[model samples]
Target: MGTDVQVLYFGILREMYVQAREEHFSLASGATVADLVERIGERHPPFVPIRERIRIAVNEEFAASGHVLSSGDTVALIPPIAGGSDRYCVVTDEPLRIDPLVDAVAGPGQGAVVAFVGTVRDENEGHEVTELRYEAYSAMALRALNSVIDRCEQSARGARVAVSHRIGELQVGDAAVVLAASAPHRAEAFAAARMCIELLKQEVPIWKRETSPDGAEWLGMRP
Candidate 1:
């Protein structure tokens, strides 16, 4: 008999599995997480190269390589937590705002605040992009975003961080994401801000589709 399980993808994995966020797969009874990973790698050749680097979580908790998977199990592939305070992480349909997030992370003792804003571009790969449609698995995205904030806070040693991502259709020049970091010094704030954005791009479950005169296509995972 086979055990049916739900596989969830984030970051690069989500881009690789552009069709859906949750997928159903059946494996032999008593299969381990490693077995499932091998099956996925077989189906998606790109996953093979980075197999060792991939992390697994079962039922919302990190799982070891030998963890046994049961029927109806939920499996998530976590890339990494690269790198917060009132540390805010959110995914909303509302437009992204920077001032509030910056204020949210700022502390009286902090001397520096750094913010990063990501906006939709008018062109990509020679195509004149008309707009961009962003989508995410809300629950997972929030968790991943929070994880990134936590990492940033840890790396900056008490630095505060805030991040907000906008989802749904967005016109060119619209702010798609906003991140802010505050620390006792400029160096820590800048480093935390950079780490937050990089990790968010590499770990969050958010996915973007570009619409252009040529049609629409999902942007692939960043290398």
Candidate 2:
């Protein structure tokens, strides 16, 4: 007897293999997430090196490596994401514009509005980069961003916050993120804007993949 499982690949993992996005696997009964990973490692040697950084999600929920797998279970291989929704918190592949984001949070009674933009640079880690790819788990990522905005709003009285992150491939000089905040005073607006950017980078599931003349690699998954 064995457990039949479906495996899914997302973000930077999709570029690792030439096969379809989803694959089926057979694991011995009572297998754990680690067991399933070992099986995957056998076929895809590239996974072995970064195996420790990869997280396993069983049935759409994060699971421990030791969790037991059941027959017909669906598993996803999640790489560290770059991280979150609506007009206030957006996750899009289209070009990011600062004006719209600024407007979203700007309104009457607000004396100061601050905006931040993160652009693709030509150099990183002493390497000459040509392109960068951002991957994300959209729905979940959006929720995370919303949480950030909610917290910023609560911390800064009368402050409004909005953020947008761009997904997919981007060239040098492309805008990757647009964040804005408005408040009754300049100090409040600045504080809210800082909180949003810091939280967005740390908690968001958006992952960055840098491409240079040598090759491309997904960051934040180091062993």
Clashes of each: 5, 12
lDDT of 1 at 175: 97
- The runs of at least 3 residues in candidate 1 whose Cα sits more than 4 Å from the true structure, single-residue gaps closed, are 1-85, 221-223
Q: Which candidate gets the maximum lDDT versus the true structure? A: 2
lDDT of 2: 0.81
State the lDDT of candidate 2 residue by residue for 88-203, as single tens digits: 56676667778766766788889999999999999987889999999888768866887888889889788989787989999999999999999999999999999999999999
Which digits, one per residue and each the tens of the lDDT, describe model 1 over residues 1-223? 8999998775445565433566789999999999999998888787787777676768755578899999989887754333311235657665666876786678789999999999988988777999999999876887788888888888977688888798899999999999899999999999999999999999998899989997888899536
As for model 1, its CA RMSD to the true structure in angstroms is 11.2
* Candidate 2 Cα RMSD after full superposition onto the native fold (Å): 13.2
Predictions in order: lDDT: 0.80, 0.81
